[model samples]
Target: MLDEGFTYGGLLMGLAALVLWIRLALRAFPSVETMIARYQDEFVVPEARSHGELGRIAACATAMALTFSAIGYAIPD
Candidate 1:
């Protein structure tokens, strides 16, 4: 169980990093709006005005990172 938790924590860390990287990349490329709109045709948007999806993804990633950190702290040596 401990090993599995550790593995999941690492995966979450990687995902968090990827999300942060994408956020930075989007910031660098202001043209992301066009790409996002292009991809929008693939699905329905529930909250079109709520900071978009990327913002929510980043927020979720940040929350996962914090949860992992807390789990790590609770793990035994």
Candidate 2:
């Protein structure tokens, strides 16, 4: 019973993290025009760079979520 609860909790948290990742990605790369504009400026594109960083963070969050869910599923009742 307790193990099942952990599994549910992990699934919920994982879903939340996945949603967050999607939101971050959508906000960062909304359109081609916006992306091109960000890079069109000089070699140094702060906005694009920041978005890339956010993407990395989002990826990390997703990874953590997966790990947590896996651990929860592996736990014994």
Candidate 3:
């Protein structure tokens, strides 16, 4: 049960990260600025429009790492 759940979860997360990386490499990632502006009615974009491509990538990687670590902490062995 442990390997079945945790390994599969890790695999799924890896695939998601791979897809995001492909989008970044192909310049297919959506406009961060436009998204922030579009959804201004709901909430706030913490980084604003000033976080450029590299910044966005860094943020994504950091976020993914954090979330991935969360899965580990959530499912104890």
Candidate 4:
């Protein structure tokens, strides 16, 4: 039971953190394109890539996190 609790707590914390991060990001960047344009050279990593590697990384992280959370929830304790 303690293990289950820990897993659930971790999942909750991760989800909460993700939500807070996304909220902060939204607040900081009301317009993604405008923000990108403002700090294109400085902020954009993996230089010269139009699609933007950072964006791809975020997408991959989101997918992996969701998949792990689902597995955590589905696995028997």
Candidate 5:
């Protein structure tokens, strides 16, 4: 079962999703920081707050995806 295409394909897909979520989550943080730095003149920037919210959402999604990846890896077909 482990050598079969289904298992390999599923693993590959899980890995790809995990990587994408992690990358998005990481990028959101820096982008938020940059926006805040670039717009320091403004007392409050809605865009920065939105980006921060996006970062939190992405981080949560990444954590969930990572947990699923770990579970998938731990359990064998």
Candidate 6:
């Protein structure tokens, strides 16, 4: 009962996180290209390279969501 609810909740949370991170990564893609072109000759700081970080986060979120959903479904009702 309570455990089932928690399992579903975690699954849903993971899915939501995956969606948000993917959205952010997509939005940042264009800007990332532009930033690279604009700063081709300059030394861009690590803090400014957020698009790469967002991509990594999105990938992790996707993996997390997949694992969470798998575990949730594998749990016996």
Q: Candidate 3 — which residues are off by over 4 angstroms?
A: 28-77
Candidate 6 clash pair list:
none
Best by lDDT: 2
Candidate 2 vs candidate 5: which has greater lDDT? Answer: 2
lDDT of each: 0.65, 0.69, 0.60, 0.59, 0.59, 0.67
- Over 4 Å off in model 6, which ranges? 2-7, 25-49
Using TM-score as the measure, what is the rank order of every candidate, best first?
2, 6, 1, 4, 5, 3
> lDDT by residue for model 2 over 1-77, one digit each (tens)?
76666667777767877887788767765467656776787343344435576677767767777776687778875
Tens digits of per-residue lDDT for model 5 on 25-64?
6655655665776678755443443455555665665565
Which of the numbered candidates is closest to the native, going by highest TM-score? 2
Measured with C-alpha atoms, the lDDT of residue 61 in candidate 1 is 73
Better candidate by TM-score, 1 or 3? 1
TM-score per candidate, chains pooled: 0.45, 0.51, 0.39, 0.41, 0.40, 0.49
For residues 1-77, what per-residue lDDT tens digits would candidate 6 score against the true structure?
Answer: 65466567668768777787768856755557568856687755544545667677767766776776676667787
Whose lDDT is higher: candidate 3's or candidate 5's? 3
lDDT of 3 by residue, 1-77 (tens): 66445555655666766666665565544567757776786554444334367556755765665566567657757
Reference-based lDDT, residue 31, model 4: 61
Clash totals, every prediction: 0, 0, 0, 0, 0, 0
Error of 6 at 42 (Å): 20
TM-score: which is higher, 1 or 6?
6
lDDT accuracy of residue 74 in candidate 5: 67
